[model samples]
Target: MKHIRNFCIIAHIDHGKSTLADRLLEFTSTVSERDAQAQVLDNMDIERERGITIKSHAIQMDYLLDGEKYVLNLIDTPGHVDFSYEVSRSIAACEGALLIVDSTQGIQAQTISNLYKAIEHDLHIIPVMNKMDLPNAMPDEVEDQILELIGGKREDIIHASGKTGMGIENILRAIVHDVPPPVGDSAKPLQCMIFDSVFNSFRGIIAYFKVVNGEIRKGDLVKFMATGKEYHADEVGVLRLEMEPRKMLGAGDVGYIISGIKTSKEVKVGDTITHVKGGCQNRVEGFEEVKPMVFAGVYPIDSDDYEDLRASMEKLQLNDASLTFEPESSAALGFGFRCGFLGMLHMEIIQERLEREFDMNVITTVPNVPYIVHTKKGEQVEVHNPSGLPEQTIIDWIDEPYIHAQIITKSEYIGQIMNLCLTKRGEMVKQEYLTADRVELSYNMPLAEIVFDFYDKLKSISKGYASFDYQPIGFKPAKLIKLDILLNGESVDALSTLIHFDNAQPLGRRMCEKLKELIPRQQFDIAIQAAIGSKIISRETVKAVRKDVTAKCYGGDISRKRKLLEKQKKGKKRMKQVGNVEVPQKAFMAVLKLD
Candidate 1:
């Protein structure tokens, strides 16, 4: 019998969790010479497009270590903050994890965070110093940090490079020697944690889970602990890592299920499953209810794809539980919907998926941070989308979103970064000098400040030396506004916001220019205006082409050209027809980009 070991690879984004998975597969000979890729576990088109792992994936490989047959079940986890919940869910399914810290970079903010999450989960950790091929690889310093902070055996840190395939065998040996096999009653009632699952038309709900305690087979009936929903299993199989199916999935195994289900929705992941007879009414808790940190409404550019767009969102929700949408009628876009996401990257990812996979053109509003208000009138309310703000309600109290970010960079450029932070009203909470030349700075920064250009700003000021990691820190009260963009004195629902008082003017100027860029040349001179309630501070003019319709008209019909221009004007009319120049998607996009 093969000894089974379940493990997840945890690290910061681009720290190479997927790359580590690829190396594991190669070392174990799970994937052949021709079947290997850089990050094989990143299977989706969007994942490849964004060059990031959006979903958690699992693969099983059989490794022969020191005359022993060890079956390794590897879970590749997402490293970005948006997918942290997904990361936790995947970690819940594993008994051990390989902490892949960059050797040259040492332990970063996210590396520390990921390590803490694993420790909190009570998972045995096997730390590995990866990227030894890089010139800055400091196995000793990282090894010290792991011991000082994580309190693990410092000598256990394995030096390896997943990219160069160096010291990989030692990693395999550590997995077998350091991590223990999962111990649970395989013959008892089935109990598993549903981290994430998807529905396949051919297969019901392909729920991926860990057998926390018990055995579940093809015919087993399982009940969700939360909703009391039950689904009969059609098949249970493990991804063999070789593009083939494995015969069985048991405790300490990472794999997928193919049930006679149709939707990933039914098996809504994070729900615990137990055999009906076991009455294991106990369900796993601590699942964070992630609120969308950023808000944007989306609509089809072409009116005919309305139904298609709805269907696309519906299908997308099955795989992405975080992408949220609700009915939102836009004055300009007609019947569109408001969507919520964790961040700008999340918004872009969803938009890209709709365009690439669903093949639909879309127009998106400016991304805004959500706010929760508690009025003195003893009424509490939440405003997710800026367009959903009520006009008549008397303002009593207001709150805005904020985040706690951990940043690590060289000490030489701290002044530059500090100056940048001051511009955003960032409060420095703490600072620590890790080495002679490096420092770690922690700050309480508004989510809005970091969402758009902070990452790029940090990189530029630090000379590409600074690194960062952050998580949402909940809401804080601040002076904010729903600065509406009015075209020709009409309010465009698409150009609205919840902004800090200080940023209003700069943002206003940026919005005006973006509108000018996105708007096409028209037959009439149009005024592009930016305002905060009737106060127009910045303005631009889109001089319409004097004679866009040439001397030659088809069928002597300037009437046809007039009809075309009328259609264009009608589209602008849907927008808050401010002045004559139409504000295109680019205008709303100004806030999302950095100068």
Candidate 2:
């Protein structure tokens, strides 16, 4: 019998997980010399440009070793902390994990985290120390860390340069020896877990499921174990990695299933796919739905793109089950989507793809951390969107989410990093020295303060030599206020916000600068100010320049100025005339740009 091996590649973000995947495809002869590229798993243009894998991708390769053909099913997992939950889910689906530790960097925070998760799952661990070709690679030190930290057998660690294709055979032999074959009764009623889904205008919705047992044909009737909503399979096919698609996927195989499904919400990840024999049995456990930690409203720059923007959101939702969005209306932005994400990277990545992939122009609202507002009536309201806030209700208490952050860096800069964390209202929970040269510092930080550029500040203060990672640490009662911007007594849609007191000052300056950059220049003196109540913390002027009227029109005719103003203000009905000056989009945008 041919052994079925299923495993995923695990590594810290930017530690060459995707790069190593491309090499795996080449060595396995999945892609010939005629067709190959770097980071082949990253199919999206934005993913390639960002040099990160935002989603998990899996591919099956047929390898021949010692005159025996073996099937190698590889899952490439994302490395960013924002997508760590998805990474965990991917790990859950696999029987084993290829723990790729950077030879140069040793074990990073994420490296430890992923390894820990893989261990918890009890998956066979195949430790592969990567980047052996790099100048900083210390294979001996990395091996020691793996053996000491993970306490795995020293011989289990496979030293390889994923970039250069060194020690691949050893890694493969380890998989065959350590990782067990897929286990299940192939003849039982169909039972599989939906790992991902995609939308098809022609076929409706296609779900990717791993068949645990039984067989599902093209006409098999299936139901979502969690929702109990039945769906008929129109096609049961395999995704040949980045190549073409296949017709059928058998037990222990990973593939997509097309069905008469309209909404992706119907076939969610972690849902079970079982044949309708007598009654559904062995239903896969649905993953706990993850609550979004960060949120922002997206509006189209051109109102005409509103429908397109909504459609784009639909497409994104189909592939990414973690994303959350709902229709939203703004006084200035009109109709758009209020989106929720796992974290900042997740938020930014979705926004960037909307503009690049869909080619839709979007003006996004500032990010807001989730909060629990206690009403005067003693009922607690969990606020995910600012628009969802109870406008008329009086809030007696408000609690904001906090994060437990552990920063490991050189001991020489321990005091510097600690001072910076304190300035941001972080409470030191623990601090310890691991060695004479390294220290670990932990803190509980307000989610709002750390939401914007916190990572950047950490790197700047650490002199770029430190490693930073954090996880949610529940909530804390906080004194918070919403800083509203008044544009001539009317609150500007882009200007209103809610911020905790401790972050209001520093965030005010950074936000002001970003607004100014995003906003265009105006024709009149526009006041750009950030404040809480009557206290103005930062101010910048959008000096409205006199409108550029041609000095000469054929023959020194200044009447051209009148015609120019009319032409410039023609399509912009949103413009308001304050005296003889016309306020355009640029002016409103300039105020937002103010530092």
**Model 1 lDDT on a 0 to 1 scale:** 0.76
Q: Write the per-residue lDDT of candidate 2 for residues 190-277, one digit (tens) a residue.
A: 7888887777778788887788877777777777787788877777776665534555556788777877888656767788888666
Report the CA-based lDDT of candidate 2 relative to the real structure. 0.75
Off by over 4 Å in 1: 225-227, 242-248, 277-279, 547-582
Candidate 2 Cα errors over 4 Å, as ranges:
65-67, 200-203, 226-232, 242-248, 260-262, 386-393, 505-524, 533-595
Q: Best-fitting candidate, measured by TM-score?
A: 1
Q: Rate the local accuracy (lDDT) of all candidates.
A: 0.76, 0.75
* Residue 456's lDDT in candidate 1: 81
lDDT of 1 by residue, 1-595 (tens): 2399888999877777788789889878888989888788888887887789988888888888778788888889888777776777767777789988877776777777887888888888888888889887777877787677677566677888888888888888888887878877677666677777664556555667777666666677777776677766666777775324455556556666665665434656677778777646577564665577777789888777888898788777767777788877787877777888877667888888888878988998877777777776767689877766655356676787778888889899999999998898899999999887789999999987777778789889998778888887878888877676665566777877777888888877877777777778765556767776667878877775654433345576667878876776675555434444356666566556747
Error of 1 at 541 (Å): 2.6
